[model samples]
Target: MGRMTDQPARWTQATVYPDMWVDPDDDPRNSEGRAPDGELATLADFLANYRMTLRMKCEGLDAEQLARRSAPPSTMSLLGLVRHLAEAERDWRRWISDGDPLPKLYGARDADFDGAVAEPGEIEAAYEALAREQAATDAALAAHPDLGERLGRDGIAVRELLVHRIEEYARHCGHADLLRERIDGRVGQ
Candidate 1:
């Protein structure tokens, strides 16, 4: 949640920490990966890990830092990622599960990232949006348990979407890692 401005040097009590962002013993997100007996369980596990990784990277930052664009020329901020994921979650619900062609969460054409400006109360709002969108999407996915069965007009399998969701989160988590590192010297997870 805090930043190390120098990026090159920061306090790490030891070089070998157990997890990204914190030691495994202290990380709330840390857990033993389960031996999933089904495709849905496996996909859900990875998706949840990456999803929580993003949130963990955002811990303790104020709006200014959250909205701070770590890599210049790229509109990807930690907050922006949060906002984008919120849109993504909604997209999954409307276009994939529900098959409703609704407008973008923020607006058209990357508005989720574009509109991710630093403002008072916006950080909390974005987090809330992400949570809400994820919950709705989760409920929809839970409603249809057959992973091999295709859903919606896209002809994408439920299993495919679940895997895609994990991929999406993992990609964003990578961005968050570099961004958080640059914003402050802290890096991990």
Candidate 2:
């Protein structure tokens, strides 16, 4: 975004660490030595951190604040990110769990973001849906047990799927960072 000529320019998020989201001590995603060494464990930890970061970014926000499309010209919002991630989790779980390729959550069109309305129940429901999707995905992963196992029509590897899920959340959490900062001056997960 370009700086406005009329209004004073704003800066990107700043914290105790200029180059980091937060100080290492306060950073919630600081897995450090706690993160295990297995492939599955590594992917799971990254995905969990991203998911938790998303939730942290949305905490204490009201429906309007959560739904605010503060970044205009783009329909992205904290609520939209939550809803979108829920749909994504469902899609990934269906593929990983050997479920039929049912219709997409919001259809082929990017209806997920388009339909991200900031209504009363939607905010609560969005978070609930995200939690439900996460639980179902975790249960399915537990059943598989083997990271190298394949699923879906393409014979996609379970490890690949898990990595993709982490990538998805990482991408969206970046957007959520901006969205949350826009909603409130607060920054960091």
Candidate 3:
């Protein structure tokens, strides 16, 4: 098998136990008890798990690693994903709340990814922004438990929004998985 750098070959090239981002015992995404029973609960649980997966994939990496592009032609990076997700969470909150249109967190266009720099402060700020947006979105969603409730100018249902959010996170988390694996030969669920 080929290797990108002198660093040890990826776990895919060798046999490793568990083959996960973290040990099952310490994996926060692992369910310890009864699973969610209702539709909303199930969707929320999925979203939460994906969110944790993103965090876990980015764990143990420094700023440079987090901001490194998957390849020269791509702007994708764990740090950029963090910023993009933060933007998404904010948009979700806005869609549910009544107010003037909120400005973009990173400026217009694909600034979120383009602006993801490998500076310590930028890394901290990206994570902080993501946390803030996630909390705000969660609070807003909590206030509207009725998934059938329609929101935003398009009158999209909350149920649809939740599903869309889950899909978004899932896709991004997959990207995070590959990015993390490339960064450290570490691969897992």
The candidate that wins on TM-score is 3
lDDT of 3 by residue, 82-126 (tens): 999999999887777667767899998889999999999999999
Residue 145's C-alpha lDDT in candidate 3?
A: 94
- Badly placed stretches (over 4 Å) of model 2 are 1-26, 97-99, 106-108
TM-score of each: 0.87, 0.81, 0.89
How would the candidate models be sorted by TM-score, starting from the highest? Answer: 3, 1, 2
- Misplaced by over 4 Å in model 1 are 1-8, 11-20
Candidate lDDT scores, in order, read: 0.79, 0.76, 0.86
Q: Candidate 2: worst 10 consecutive residues by lDDT?
A: 5-14
Model 1 clashing residue pairs (backbone): 1-59, 3-184, 4-184, 4-185, 20-188, 20-189
Put down candidate 1 lDDT per residue, 122-166, tens digits, no spaces.
Answer: 887898999998998999888789988788877778888888889
Give one digit per residue, the lDDT tens place, for model 2 in 1-189. Answer: 965653223332445665444566766775666667788878888888888889878878788888888555888888888889888888887676555755666666667777778687777777888898889888877888688889877788888888889899989888887776666656544
Taking every candidate in turn, the Cα RMSD to the unseen true structure, in Å, is 4.1, 3.6, 2.8
